[model samples]
Target: MDARRNDVNPQKYYVKKLCKIIYFMGLGDCWYERTEQSRMQKILYAIWATLINSFIILNTINELLAFLRTDLSVKEKNDSIQFRFAHPCLCGKYIFLVLQKHRIRALFERLLEASRSVYTVFEVEKRSVWQAKLCCLVLAASSYCTLLFTVVDAIVGYFTQGIKIRTEVVLYPTPAHSGLLINLLRLLIEVHWWCIVTNMILVDCLSSVAMVYVAHKLMIVKLYFQNLRQKVISNIGKKSDLEIQKEYEMDFITGVKLHKDALWCAKNIQYALGNVYSIQVFESITLLGMCMVKMAKIDINLTFILANGLYLVCVVIITGVYFSSAGNITYEAYEVHNAMFHSGWELAHLSPASRAVVLVAIQRSQVPVFLTAFGVVVLSHNNFISVVRASYSFFAVTY
Candidate 1:
């Protein structure tokens, strides 16, 4: 009964912590915080709880295997949702070590390559245009095919499966299901669940891509600024106003370059926050829209409406919390702005020959942003298509 006793015991403490880890990793909430319990007892409790809950989840999924075979498993159907709920892939335990030894160097190598390719205009370069377009087209076609398949499958199921097609109506009935208003609310709630899950997944994926790409872009910009900073420092012996200003510009650029990686990391955080912002807005609209549709479809508030509403609220809150940590996107943009002006200033101060070189470097620096923006716009459009298809299933039920 003395849980505290177990706390002092390392083995017991380890087990308890392990259980909490398991629950936190997959399960939504950790209602079982062991403080008063003894170390040994807490450890045992955690191990037992984790095993039991995991078994329940596994068995439930297994029972639904047949249904999943014909329909989508919650995991498959809810890929985006599950993906969003999971921790970012960037936060690995060994990442810092990898970054220290390899990632940083690798990033620098990439920057070097980017720098070498600075001769071409970023947006209008003729060399890679067809290649980029081809890639984009291929990606778009694949995503479109997937979306079409999901749509056709859902439509076929809606017509063939009869009334039982509404998974919420059959499996999650409540006392109020007998009422028309309550059934409609239940339907709305189910729709909300699916939408939230899918949207979150999309946002997570987009965030990951944005973070990595932005980090690389920032790294290149940082290097360029660093070169300028060094140039100014080298010229410090010549103390004329132009030289001093050049030196000052160099120092400013150097600072920007030094903070480039940090700024890049910050941009990723901002992108993730932007994702949260957009997802929250979408979820809010979903709930409100679902409520109106509920009245039209079943004539009452579905019983699960409150539960789904609470879940949505929690998601919104948690995402908002993440967004809060990310701070402002504009801050990173401003830093980039400063870097640009300084680089341009350096070009102006340079001899005609050096000015040409600086101009090329500046042009090259803009390439990554242009390409990334274009990629995101295209990929996200595909994601939008998926979102539409996923929603059609729930709509079929109402029809």
Candidate 2:
């Protein structure tokens, strides 16, 4: 199948937009073809990327220093003051930025490759187009909602309190007094913070969307096997022994090929996202606990409750979707064996070669497919539940 034939594909449309945004942020240079550009243009892009990335690095360092200074000062004046909640939040953002800076090229390339694999799957099944479209819509909605909420909260806080609210993990020091120049600087800072927050959210959405699409494809593959099984079983009384054997052999070979393709795609997903998954899992666990602690300490007010509640809910939903989709992929792969057995493979008359192929397919399907974080912790609903429970336990102890 020609992956590029789907010029109007919603999945491709959104993924391309995401790549453009990432490139515009100056986080990566691989989004476009460098070979098409002149030498001078390539050098200019390199220079621009370096300057933009350096600015982000310097800003992160300044924020980290400010956080440390404030944390120390608060501890000294009030021994009971613990910045426990803030530390992990800050560290997670820092780690993410550093990793993204260094790994953007590899990450983007792998994501593009995985997306092509998914596109191939869609080409095989016409009905899967609806799933692809729905995935794109969900991603766009999530990204827009997050951006709108962050911008609205920041604007409201700034106008009402004459203080710039950091909507993200950056710990910028507030200005001591209000002036025209100070206000403008604060506005710029807020805009920059908003961009960073938007990028972070988009990255998470992209990764989650990709995983969900893969799960959808896996489900399609499972259905194909199931259909094949039924077809084989139904042919028992209608077909001769040689005809049945030949049909079984052909179908078994096709199933084997499909399974191999699915597994390859699964491996590509793991390679593309393993490191990012590990970091995100750690961040979600720590941040949820911290947010819960902060919410408990705040007075009961509608705004406070809504703000904190939304934050926690968004975190859970995003992480939950990712883990659940990964689990689904594994589940669909493991069902292949059952699909074969139930297809009346035992009753079908097959040649020795056909029997050997069926046996191999069953053996291959026995080992389940899983998406792991850094080749360690498997991403699944069970692990997600464990993380949530652990976060609650930590919150209780700290509170």
Candidate 3:
């Protein structure tokens, strides 16, 4: 009886302690495992929540519009409204179901564990940084794809609902008369198309930049885990003062490596930022090309509005999201590095050869991401700014 009671006490004590740790860690009891998310994770959850809400709202609005256009019976109308309201709930349930896979659970649990290491006072291997970044890449890709689909849907909706138009008259071409006004009007059309097409390209470029930035972050995460694994194995052959300490370190190291690897593999491949960047680049360019072809058939006056107003708004939104996502990714990487550096692991303490390894790893892990993000922002912002200025110029000249 006493033995059983003792066993129960330890288990209960651990549970209570874990609960307290979780509470302080800022990760609520929502995750089944006791692991907590870093700042990035919390931000990701919030962003994802906002995205889901937006999608639901947009879908609901679309459905309502459809319902208003329909001449349905009272019962059918009520049923359709109810169905639309429940759609988001159903989608949530389905997402949960997918997350229930054992492999996925393992990956999530590993990531949660990694998140904790970022705060550890001891030398932490740098692998978790890569893992977190990879996760972000996956997440950002999913969001980008959804946003792309939304854009496509919006364009389709415009076609179905009919495009808004502004009036402009074209004078008949005359061989006998050289009218400067006619030439000027034609010039305006060319300028309008140029602004619209360029703006669309800029928005597409922003999307690509976001995707690439996320991918670069993932690479860092992978490096952190790899370094951690090498450290653990290297320490295995060394003699330590306490047998228990050796065993503990080895166990922790093995567990971390395994957890990271599991999570690394289980994540949604489709969500990877690597493919998202290239694919989006191709798709966006293609879509923009199509828009240009379509625009060619329409009047220059109408195109001017879309180019100046509609495309301008899209470029702004795309640039905003791109920069925001890049900032998040960079911040998370810094946090991971800060945590691991604090973990008592010093690059200087390692042997010369080991120090080289560590330095190489850090350089590879961080530099590419920063470069990609830098390039994206520079181009996206400049293009958007140029389009805005040119549009204003066109308006000023024409009016």
Candidate 4:
């Protein structure tokens, strides 16, 4: 095992390390196994997840009922309405995260499988590796910064005001009167909040990383097609007619196989993400509008407003990145047609059989590959822009 570990590439090593961290946090398991022990572990994790999910749901309901029972003016009514809506949305987001555990595990497994399959084609290629590394770094930096800000903000608030501030999606109910047992309970609640927040951040960041990695795989496949075109052009006139024809046929077959594999990889990714993709889109738009409404309100605290603003920005940026990467995948898939078109097949003087193979390849290349969310929304830069526009419109109306 040590020897095998040492044989791994630096990029893969770092990526696996990050995935392990995510798995240990109960976000998902990258090394999913079907052993008895693995089953037992998963069962335990599921129980814990269900407990946390139930707690959040119950707390949200309690908060909602409490808000409904209170008397308020028009402004307070607006605030209450917003808060009520926001709590359920937040709970739904957490529930989405929890329910996606198995899907996340499947995604990571597919990612590893795809990477291994394509490694020989891209082992020496630095561009995709660098892009993936940059993505991982960005996710890591953002997660750390956000968590640090939450912790420091809470600590500073407590020291300055002698009151603990909650920094998680679900607010814990604490007694107003202070006592030793109450203080201990508050500390435990804070710990639980931190754990939940940390898990949420890790899951989100790792999911983004997985998407970026899949995009890199698509890029590698595209590069392979480009290289195949070069091979077709370079092999021209170098050998006898029969030999050239054979070589072209061989290359064509290889290209088809690689393209099919790439498509299969993409299909797996889409399948894994399909269930939650639309939910994520709706959540982002709704949360962005809610944050904007909170920021517009006159009586909200600056710090709270700033936090929501940061969250809104992060949601926008993350959504943009995800859709942009999906767009790149589509572009790469479509570029195959151009590569085949420019490969100088006409100049190769191929036999009828070889020409037939090239024709089939060209036909296959003409079909554009796309990743869709919930089998409805195609993930692309254009769609990303549309979502942002719609979100902004919603915010304007609400404001």
For 1-399, candidate 4 gives per-residue lDDT tens digits of: 001222445445555776667556554455444434587877898887567656545655654664544334343344455546645644554456556657666666655554454334445334555666665566455645655565665565578666455443222343354778766655655565445545544544555555666666556556655665576567666767667667666655765676676677677666655544565577667767766776677554555555555667666766776687778778877876787666556755777877887888888878877777768889898999888887888899988
| lDDT (Cα, 0-100) at 141 in candidate 3 | 51
Best by lDDT: 4
Those runs of model 3 whose alpha carbons end farther than 4 Å from true positions after fitting are 1-113, 117-279, 293-296, 300-312, 319-399
Preferred candidate (lDDT higher): 1 or 4: 4
User: How displaced is residue 244 in candidate 4, in Å?
Assistant: 1.5
- Per-residue lDDT of model 3, residues 135-207, tens digit only: 3444345434433443454354347554212111112222123468856644453333233223233223323
Candidate 4 backbone collisions, by pair:
none
Order of the predicted models by TM-score, top scorer first: 4, 2, 1, 3
TM-score per prediction, in order, is: 0.35, 0.76, 0.30, 0.77
Q: Is candidate 2 or candidate 4 better by TM-score?
A: 4
Q: Give me the runs in candidate 1 sitting further than 4 Å from their true place.
A: 1-238, 241-256, 259-304, 311-335, 342-348, 365-398
What stretches of model 4 exceed 4 Å from their correct place? 1-15, 32-111, 114-119, 123-129, 140-164, 168-177, 300-302
Candidate 2 regions with alpha-carbon error over 4 angstroms? 1-14, 29-35, 68-173, 177-181, 230-240, 374-376
